[model samples]
Target: MSLADSPIRHPDTASRPLMTRRGWWLVGMNILIPGSAQVLAGDRRLGRFGLGATLVLWVVLVAAIVTWFAAPTVIYTIASNSVALWVVALGLVFYGVLWLVLTLDTLRLVRLVRTQPSARVPIAALTVLVLVVASGGAAYGAYLATTASGFLSSVFAAGPSEPPVDGRYNILLLGADTGPDREGTRPDSMTVASIDAETGQAVLIGLPRNLEDIHFPSDSPMAAAYPNGYGTEQGCLVDVCLLNSIYTEVEQVTPELYPDAAARNSTPGIEAMRDAASGVTGLTIQYFVLIDMQGFEALIDALGGVEITVEERLPIGGDENLQNVDGWVEAGTQRMNGYTALWYARSRYSATDYDRMQRQRVLQEAILRQFTPANVLTKFQAVAEAGAETVRTDIPQSMLGYFVDLAGKTRQLPIQSVELTPETGIEPAYPDWDAVHALIQDAIATATAEPTPAESAAG
Candidate 1:
C-alpha cells in the first residue's frame, strides 16, 4: 500500500506536518529502534536491512564482551576495563550520527509522500532497511557498553578495606612462567610475602631456585640430615630446591601429559616440594598462587600495559630465546605487557638470579597498581576470567572474599621485600648440611621473634 493511497492520517495535524503525531513516531523509532520508525512511517526496505544488520552487530559485540570475562585475570580486567569508557563514548558519537542521518531521511520521506505518493511504499521499505541496519548496530553496541559498565559497577562498589587477621603473615606467590625450561611440575617464580597484619605493611622476600647447594629435603635418611643431605627441619633453604634438576625431571613428560607444561610443572606432586620448602625457610606458609603464562600475557594486554621501573637494563638475547620474540627493552621505569614482564622476571641467564628477584618485585607492584577502582571497573570481567584461566591459588573462593574485604578496609600499607640468595654468602653446596640447618633455624628465629620498639620505630 502507498502512503498517499492508504488513509492513515491524523486530523488537525496537517500544517507543520513533519511535527505531527505520525511524523514524531517516525523520529522516535529512529532514535529507539533505528529503522522501525521509518518502516512505520512507510519505509519497508530500510526496515528489513536495519533489523538484520543490528542482529549481526549485536552478536559480534556480545562475543567480545563475553571473552573478556570468560577467563578473567588482574591484567585482563585492568586492560579490558578501559573498553567500557571507549564503548560509551563511541556509542554517544554513533547516536549523534544516526540522529542527523535519520532527520534528513525523514525529510526525504515526507517529500516522497507529497510529490510521488505512488513511490512511498518502495521508498519507505528502502529507508526502513537503512534505519534498521544502523539502529541495530547502535543498539548492539549499546548492549556491549551496558554489560561492560555493569561489571565495573559491582567491582568498585566499595573502597579498599583491611584484612581479618591481626598479626604478621607470610604468603608465597608463585608465577610459573611455565615454558620450554623446567623440571618436574613446580613453580617458575616464587615470591614470599611477609604481611604485618597490625600495620598493614607488606614485605616480599624473593628467593632464587638456582643458587646451587642450599639445603632441601632429601628422600633418603642420610640426606635428610645435614651430614649426608641437607637434613633437619631448619636445615633446608631456597637453594635446596634445585631448579635445573627439577626442570630436567619434569621435561621428560610429553606435552600432552602436561598440556600447559610451564603452568603445571610446579604443580606435579607439589606437596613434597612445599613441605620441604616450608621446613627450609622456617616461615609458616599461608597461601600460594599459580598463574598461567599465556593467560597472564592476555591479561596484561587487556590492562593496556603495566608501568614498572627497570632496576637495570638488559638486552634481549638472540632467537635462541624462544620467548624473546618481543625483542629487547632498555632498563628504566616503563610500561610492560605480560610477555615482557614474564621475560624480565625469568631472565636468569642475562642477569643474576638476585636481579631477577628484583624484577619480580617490580612486577608485583605493577600488578597492585593495575587493580585500581578505575581500572577494575573498566576490565572487571575480562580480568576475572583471565585470572581464573591462568591462575590457581590455595586460597579458596570463600576465603578470597574475606581477603578482598580486609584489603579494602586497610589503607595503602607500606610494602617491603627480602631475598635469600647465594649472594648473601649462604652457599649450600660449600657449607656442611649442619651450617645450612643452622641458617634455616636462624631465619625462622628472626622471622618469628617480635620486633623491639626501637626496631619497629626505625621504619
Candidate 2:
C-alpha cells in the first residue's frame, strides 16, 4: 500500500470535539457561577478554587449586611480604621484581577473547543465586555470607598469622644462665616441639635445670634478666662458678648486665654461656643460641626437647590452697615438656587435675626428632606465634594458610621424646634438662662416621647 493512502489522519484534530451551543452555555455559566465553566471543561482543580472564591465573596457580603443591621458601631469603627480601609481596598483590587482572569480563562476554553471563527469571535467579544464591565465596577467601588475614608479623616478628629449622655447626643451646629471684612470666622448661626441615640428624634434649640452674657462651663478654659461669663467685663464691644461673637473672640484669644483647647478641638472657637451653649442649655455638648458659610451655596447647589416657603420678600445681597440690597427673592412657595438660599438664611434687611433664624430652620429642614438616598446616588460625586469643602467637625471619624445610620433615621422622623426669640419670653440681651434651660428640656421631652395618634397620622 502506498504510504500516503495507508494512514492519512490527524490525531489531535480527530480527538478534539467541534464547538457547539454548549460552548456558549459554558461562557454564560462562567459569568453566573464563576467556576462551573472550568468544571465542565475538565479543569476540576481550577474550578474548585474559583468556586471557593465566589462562595467566600458571598459570605463576606452577607456578614457585612448582618453587621450593618446588628452592630453598626463595629462597621463604623472598621471604616474609620485606616488599616482596615487599606485592606478592603486591596481586597477589591485583588477580586477585580481574579474576575478578569477567570473571564479570560473562560474565553480561552471556548476558543479551545473547535468552532467556526464567526461564532468564536462574537463569544470572545461578549466575554471581554462582561469582564471589562465587572472589573470596572469593582474598581470604581473601591475608589469611592477610599475617597470617603480620606475625606472622613480630613474632616473628623482622630479619637472617639464620649458617647451620648442619658440617651441623647447634643451636638452644636455652627454656621461660621469667614469674610475678608471680618477679623475671623464667626458663628453667625448657632443651634444645638439634641438627638435621641436610639430613636433618632431630634430637637433643635436655636440660639439668637445676639444672645449676651453667655456663660461657659465652670471647668472649661473659657470659664477660666472670663469668670463672670462672656460679657462686657471681658472687653467685648457693646454686643460683642453676643453668642455669635464667641467664636471669633475665642479664636482670637485662644493662644493666650485657652492654650489647652487647641489640643482637644481643631477649632478652639467652636469649642468655646460649645461650652457656652452647654452652660446656657444645661446639656453636655458631645461634639460640634462647624459649617463654612462660604461653601454653603455650593453645597445647596450640589443638592440641586432646595424648595422653601418664603413668608415675606428676602433680599439677595446686602451689607448690614450699608443697608443696601442687590436683589430680592419674591415671597411664596418657590424653588431657590444656592445664592437665593444663602440670602434666605442670612438676610437681615427688614427682617430681624429672629426671622432669619426661623428661615434658617426651615431651610435646614428642607435640605434634610431633599438629601434622600436617590438624590445622593444621582449626584454622589458632587455631594461628596461639596460636603468635604463645607463641613468641619470635632466628631471622630470612627463614629461617623453611627451618625450616618442615625441621620437616616432622623430623616424619617419629625424635627422639633425651640427658638429663643422674644415671643418665647427670651430676650437676647438679658436671656433668662433658667427659663431657656426649661424650654430646651421641655422640647426634648416632647420630641422624644412616642408620637400621639394625631401626630402619627399627620406624619
Regions of candidate 2 where Cα sits further than 4 Å from its true position: 1-20, 68-81, 112-121, 237-239, 319-327, 332-337, 372-380, 452-459
| TM-score to native of every candidate shown | 0.51, 0.87
Q: Compared with the true structure, what per-residue lDDT tens digits does model 1 show for residues 133-227?
A: 65565665565556555444432222233243436555667665555563334556766665655443455666566533434444422233343
> Mind giving the per-residue lDDT tens digits that candidate 2 earns over 315-424?
77777653567889899999888889988898887777788899889988888777765676577667679888898888876677678777777888889989998989
Q: Which residue pairs show backbone clashes in model 2?
A: none
Model 1 TM-score?
0.51
Best by lDDT: 2
Error of 2 at 149 (Å): 1.4
The clash numbers for all candidates, in the given order, read 70, 0
